[model samples]
Target: MNFAFTEEQQMFRDMFADFVAKEVEPLAEHISEHEEIPKALLKKAAMQGFLGALLPEEYGGAALDMVSYILLLEEVAKSDMSTAMVLHVHNDLVSRAILLCGSAEQKEQWLPAMAEGSVIGAWAFAEPDPAGLTNLQVMARAADDGYVLHGTKTWVSNAGIAGLMVVFAQAPEGPTALLVPADAAGLKLGQRDKTLGMRGVQIHPVYFNDVAVPADAVLGRPGDAQAVMAAVGDFSRLAMAAIALGGAEHALSLGVDFAKERKQFGVEIARKGAIQAYIADSAVEVETLRSQVYRCASLADQGLLDGLSASIAKLWANRVSYQVANRMIQTHGGYGYILDYAIGRVFRDCRTVEGIEGSNRTQQAAIARSVLAAHGFVM
Candidate 1:
């Protein structure tokens, strides 16, 4: 199987890279310090067709394949993780979920506007509960005309700014998902969180108090929340792996540039045996992680939900990113600790990968279970 990108894909990557370098990189320091991604930037991305890279053309998207989508994400992440966070949550997770699972009417109603960036989508998951444990304790309830949603979803990316939300809730039938308008009655956005990294994305808690959604707002079949969640988890794992790979590449590049320039003991640091060893090890790990991520992406594009592959990719990429960023920091010496340099911010962003989407321990368990199942073990 050929792993090379087509000319169109290469062009897409180059164009997007240039866009990020001009539009995103210049604002990275401001976003990291201020903790807010400018709304105008998101609008600009939308106008550039960056927000709908995965949706079908009928829905106003670029109709790009999974490889192109992942490539766009990696490019954006390489420059500013916060902007990538917004795009990932909005386009990859929420928009893709709607496209895959929404009814024909639902798609017609939501996708076009969302594709144009007139409507922003946010995924509501990740409660305070520990990883891999399903807690059917949502306060949302369905009644006569519609479902009454009441709960607090924390660590929600694009919470306050998004125009729509795909909310997962527990009901008597089973866990259900609902598409809620951001302006829906009784929905309230809490204060923005000050996270360790990925700033400017506006993570926050959304409180729903007796918020009513139309009966048609439910996504997919009833009692299929677990399945929807599993699908989302799979997509998230692959996307996060892509992001981690990009961040690792960024850190490795910075380290190489820094080592070649900095003088130590009357010579360039790049000439030092120890620094060369660090660069070699980081390059090897980054390439390995990139291959694994691409494998998972290819499998997913083929509609193969290979849970073990996804989990392994996510686990390895996350760990590799952390190691690479830390080493980059070490190579930069005192300069790495300063906020003006991108290495420190990249380091913090890399650390967040191990915990989000699903923790490393959870991914390990999933992989183990898949292995046992493949070997004919049950339960």
Candidate 2:
């Protein structure tokens, strides 16, 4: 039941915070306005060893533990949410998947370049008709030379920038994941698809029109896409919550500051009982969410994570992060609604959190199944 961060972990957190303060925070507005993350900033993060946060040291990575990775992501999100998300997709999703399931040859070929920021990574799981693999619109058919993947992937993060991608499609075997080079023939990177928020993040649609790849491109086992994707989902669920909590904490800070600074009726709004209550409630909620996320992350580090724990954390984040953002806006009144303030960006972004990864409704089903299984009940 030990709960304190180690000295090394604290140092890592402070280093990440300092990096964000100097590099990411200043560019938050610029990124939002321009809708792009400067390549230089990503290279700076690579130099800081963040791009390789999950890989083993042998792969030229920092080999950070789950807790440290979570901490780094939260701090990044605190300064810039889109930057945190791109890191999550690259480090937590793509790289972690390769580390966990990729062949030694695959690891040797990709990890070093990814760590060096010479290559960027993206995950293409969602589709125009995303039914997981059970009802995949994209299908991969085996040829004598290899496999040809045909279908469109929607809402793919880092699509335009990534030199490599991990793609999932239905195969002669069940669902299958394959490594597709960004420049592969028949692989078309569509224009950036705009969304509700996270403007700096480049999410796009990709049409895989008979893209062929060698047999060695298959990830994990040929028919093991379900399990591979499930594993990634657990990591993604926890990571999404950490990102959301960062937004919530930032929102609380904005609210408390505005409450203290904005005067009303000859006194500070901080003097108002309502303002005091919002601040108090937000602080408590944020701290509790933080603890839950860390606890889940700890379980993951210890190999104890399951869908249930991850879902609980995501549900907490999805429900409460939005509430906290709304409170921040209410505290700001007309100013919060204005897009000029960074808090407004947090508010817009937090709303979309409910729908990304797995939605709240989907998570509920997972949590329910796990809970029932804990008892003698079977579905």
Candidate 3:
């Protein structure tokens, strides 16, 4: 029940904070404005073990625990949710996917480059169809050598720059996940999508037009959707929590700073009752989410957390983050709404985290399912 971070974890947090202060914060606007992550920063982040925090030391990765990874994600997201989104995709969705479900052979083949940042990865879990099917819609038919993939995935984060992608598909064996290289023949990327937020992070609809890959490309046992999803859901939810918490904390900090500096009636806004209440609420909310995040992350590190816990953490944190960010913007008065200030970006960025890793609505359904199962309901 001790939620205090270990001294080592605190030190790691401080180190990452320094890195973010110097490298990431300066480039947040640049990335958000251009929808691009600088190549050099990517290299530096890899060197800092962000890209492959879960990979074992044998593969040139830091092999960080779930708690430490959460800390890193939180610090980075505070500066730029877009860059944070990219890191989460590469680390949690891609690298972590392989480590959790990847075959030993597959790990050997790809984990090194992934850990070194020489290769970036994406995980495509959604379909492009208008019907909104959550299941893998891409079809992979067995060919003479391996398989031919035919389908498209929309709003795939990290697709634009990913050197490799873990694509889920309907294979002959059933729902399967394949490790498809970016340059595979017949693979086509749709135009970069103009997203409302996270515009700096490239996303698109990826088309697998008879894209082919060898049998070894399979990440794990094909058709074991339950196994793959069980692993994916937990970390995805935790990662989203980290992203949201970071934004919330940063927005709250921004509001506090602005309050102290802005004055009305010859008194600092910090002394005003209304502005102080906003800060008070935001401060409390940030701590509340922080407690949930660390508690769940600790449980995950101990292997005591279930998918239900992850979903609940994400559901609550995402909602709270938006609330906190919105309040901070309100506290800033007219200045917050302007693009020149960072709070406006934080407002939009938090909204995007709410939708990803399955939307807040999706998490509600998942949490309900868990409740039913706990209550002895069976299908």
Candidate 4:
């Protein structure tokens, strides 16, 4: 089967690459050092149609296909993973959830603004529970006319900056999601989290204390939160895998360039057997990840729900990213560990993929369950 991108897709990828090189790469060092997300950069991305890549055209989005979205994600990730993450959270998790589950009016109200970047969306799901099973905990209770939300969401990206949030909470009926206004009363945005990687995307804790939202705030039916979350989870895992693949590809490219230029014992490092082996191994890993990501994306685009494939791609891609980045760092020796070098930041960023969007261990269990079910195994 032909795996090459279409002409239009190629053009889209090139355009995104140019945008990242011109707008994001220059600010990467400053963002990493200060842990600041450049709001203007996000606005620029919105204006350029990057924020709405997957939304329908009626909602002001380009409504590009999933492969095109993946291409754009990869290009953005290659420059600044943090900035790429901001777009990913907005597009894949928040906006996609609304599109997939919200009522028609809800879509009309939120999708256009979200696509225009006037309303940024954040996903609030992760918590500090050691078990990491916050989905089963009821944090908000539905009242007669509205819901009283009470809970704390940790590691929430764009918590303070986003205009809207899709908060997963437990309701009296069951697990549910509420679309909360960022400026809602009784809602608090905690101080920025100091993470080792993806610093340009602000991570914060969100506290909802007696925050009231109308009945219409519910996304889909009550007790359908798990379904909505599962869909989001699948898309997010695959998208994150694509991002990791992009980072690994970037790391490989840099390693190759550096090896070709750096000389040792009066010969270029690229010519050495060890360096050559490292490059070869990294290339293999990156290519494999690319294939897995594309296959997952294709399946999603076709409306084929393959949780197993999504988990496999996410698990493998995350591990491959860490391996590729670590090897690249080793190849660069002392220089790779320094802040001045981009590999150091990429290395840290790569580590985050395995943990976020569900950990590799979680993916493994999910995959195992899928295998058992296919084989008619009953627990």
lDDT (Cα, 0-100) at 30 in candidate 2: 90
Give the clashing residue pairs of candidate 1, or none.
none
lDDT of 2 by residue, 1-379 (tens): 9799989989999999999999999998898788889999999999999999988899999998889999998999887788988898998888888878888998998999999988899998889966767778899998998799999999988887899999988888878888898999999988898877778889999999999988898889997887677767887899999999888888888788888889988899999898888888888889889999999888888988888889999998998789999998999988898887778988877776787777789889988998898897989
Instruction: Give all candidates' CA lDDT scores.
Output: 0.84, 0.88, 0.86, 0.85
The backbone clash count of each candidate, in order, is 0, 0, 1, 0
**Model 3 TM-score, 2 decimals:** 0.96
The sequence of per-residue lDDT tens digits that candidate 4 reaches over residues 284-326 is: 8898899989877877778874788989999898789999998
Give RMSD to native, each candidate. Answer: 1.5, 1.1, 1.6, 1.5
Q: What TM-score fits each model?
A: 0.96, 0.98, 0.96, 0.96
Tens digits of per-residue lDDT for model 1, 202-295: 8888888889988788888765777667666787788888888888898999999999999988899999898898899999999999888877
Error of 4 at 293 (Å): 1.0
TM-score of 1: 0.96
Model 2 TM-score, 2 decimals: 0.98
The stretch of ten residues in a row with the least summed lDDT in candidate 3 is: 128-137
